[model samples]
Target: MSGESAKGQKSYTNALLRLENITKAFGNTKVLNGVSLTVGAGEFLTLLGSSGCGKTTTLRIIAGLERPDSGRVFLEERDITYSEPNKRDVNTVFQNYALFPHMNVESNVGYSLRIRSVNKVEIKQRVADALRLTRMDEYAKRMPTELSGGQMQRVAIARAIINRPKLLLLDEPLGALDLQLRRRMQIELKRLQRELGIAFIYITHDQEEALNMSDRIAVIRGGLLEQTGGAAEIYDAPRTSYVARFVGSANILRGVSALSSLLPNEIIAVRGENIVMEPYSEQSRGLKGVVTDKRFAGGMLRISARLNQSGAEVVSSRHGIDSPLTPGQSVSVSWDAASEIVVKDNDTGEVS
Candidate 1:
């Protein structure tokens, strides 16, 4: 399970790749449990989850870096679960820009081509084409040490793409960069994937990255697939309590459903955000609470209010809102029932 395979080439499959019920374990720890997903041709799918949640294990399974204990994988409908890493039409770009310091940029990119016994002319052509696509053509003769983190990472990407793999696996490809560079690379990676027309299975713990880049997101929790949906679907209608708090800045509140409110309690979660906080309107049907804290972030004012019954504090940030009072101020907090996301834990039966 922990060994390297010799570099070799195989006939390229026309289909991208598909993973079905892939499960993996290490020692006594179960990493991936019954994970099933598909990466269509020319698509970008992201595996988003927190640390130790099996995102990385799933990526490794796709890359042929780790063999699943059960399930199967297919490229173009051809079974390849036992296929060698180099034989599969896939490549992975590690988080730590895996570039060779001794090798120049061109060598790094063309290394796989060399292993495949590609002719010198074809290798040179592919190296030039890949480098040009990543905007690193001029640095062909430069060594890995000669480039910055972002630049070297581009070299890593160029190296992966040069192989002309049908599927590209990116494990936090932009994780090493600073915030600004990471944002820039996110745009760059998306654009590059579009231009390549190849399937991308991206893995990351960052939800924002998943929202921004993925055509579809597969959320994993506790080694299980929680939910898979588009950005709007998962953010707006989270299937579980864990999902709502994980995807965005969620403000979970407690409220007993008033049946005659002209709206379903299910839709109450959406109405909580639009609740008017200005001078507490009398028409608002909300829990009375004390405002415990306030934070001014840029153009938005965040208010943390504690409910009277359970003393559970719900946070709401109002845009272009400035409060007239200080912290620990006494205020009757109210929110339209329509704006709240009514989440109930199945085990505890407590509304989140």
Candidate 2:
């Protein structure tokens, strides 16, 4: 399900957008601190982070909705750090569809061109093309109030793309949809991006969404970029404990000297799926632990255990519904040495 390798090959020699040492703050609280990133032409890059982590702020800055207190923004090699939103070659699709309730889909999609006094015939033709690209051509006659959430979202996308901007910024555009609809939209959005061959800077807090749709993900934390890489790279080799635990469910093992040597501020991060758990015995070859909890999660069994020596809680996953693990059972928790990822404690500096 990862497009890391194929998407990673997209060239950045002709970068579409670049932010240099961007910094922003409101009143006394700094929201963004020295962030810099680039979006290659036609590449799908996702800015991922939890709410208020500055992902949205970064997006707004790119879209010209917010200005960075410091740093420069360039699009197609032209500095646009202070350019008016209307002058920038950028378009945005927000979580809310923002479609006019009084307008039909066709009118909404053509509004930007119409407002600019584009020829009527050209607006009509372009609107149709945009709607068809989004697979919503047949619904052009429908009013915004009459469309389903997904349909409305499609219309919003059509509207945003009708002008054919070089870079499209989507600010959690699918967040309002139901789970099933959201998943379907993810695929549709990626397909549309490829077909358009335009760069997309998508914003989302959903790690799964980022992994499934992004060529590269920029993990943001505390107003700064924590790490940025393809889906597989970020997942398999996170640079810090915060990224390891934030991007997915990682069990942070602290003070576990048996696994590897660590400083007082360092820790180990082992993914649940990478751990191997077995019934504990005198001859067991790993840390002894007692199962503290077990649950059947559809196709896999999730087991949580507490290591007897370090009192560290570890989670492991086993395929199938037949796992016989019980809460009170003793088990040996071990993982391949290669699977042990020694990461820096985010609060402290990087581990040497």
Among these predicted structures, which one has the highest TM-score?
Answer: 2
Cα deviation of 38, candidate 1, in Å:
1.6
In terms of lDDT, the poorest run of 10 residues in model 1 is 1-10
Least accurate 10 contiguous residues by lDDT in model 2: 1-10
Off by over 4 Å in 1: 1-15, 254-272, 275-284, 296-299, 342-352
What stretches of model 2 exceed 4 Å from their correct place?
1-9, 261-265, 347-352
lDDT of 1: 0.75
Query: When superposed on Cα atoms, how far off is each prediction in RMSD?
Result: 6.6, 4.0
Best by lDDT: 2
lDDT value, residue 92 of candidate 2: 91
| 1-352: candidate 2 lDDT, tens digit per residue | 1222335437666678999999999999999999999888878999998888899999999989999999999998899999999999899998798999899999999999998999999999999999989989999899998999999999999998888788889999999899999999999999888877778999998899999999999999889999999998888889889888878668788767636777766778989988889988899998999999988774688899999999988989754566767899999988887778888888332221
Count of clashes, each model: 9, 0
> In model 2, which residue pairs have backbone atoms overlapping below 3 Å?
none
What TM-score fits each model?
0.85, 0.92
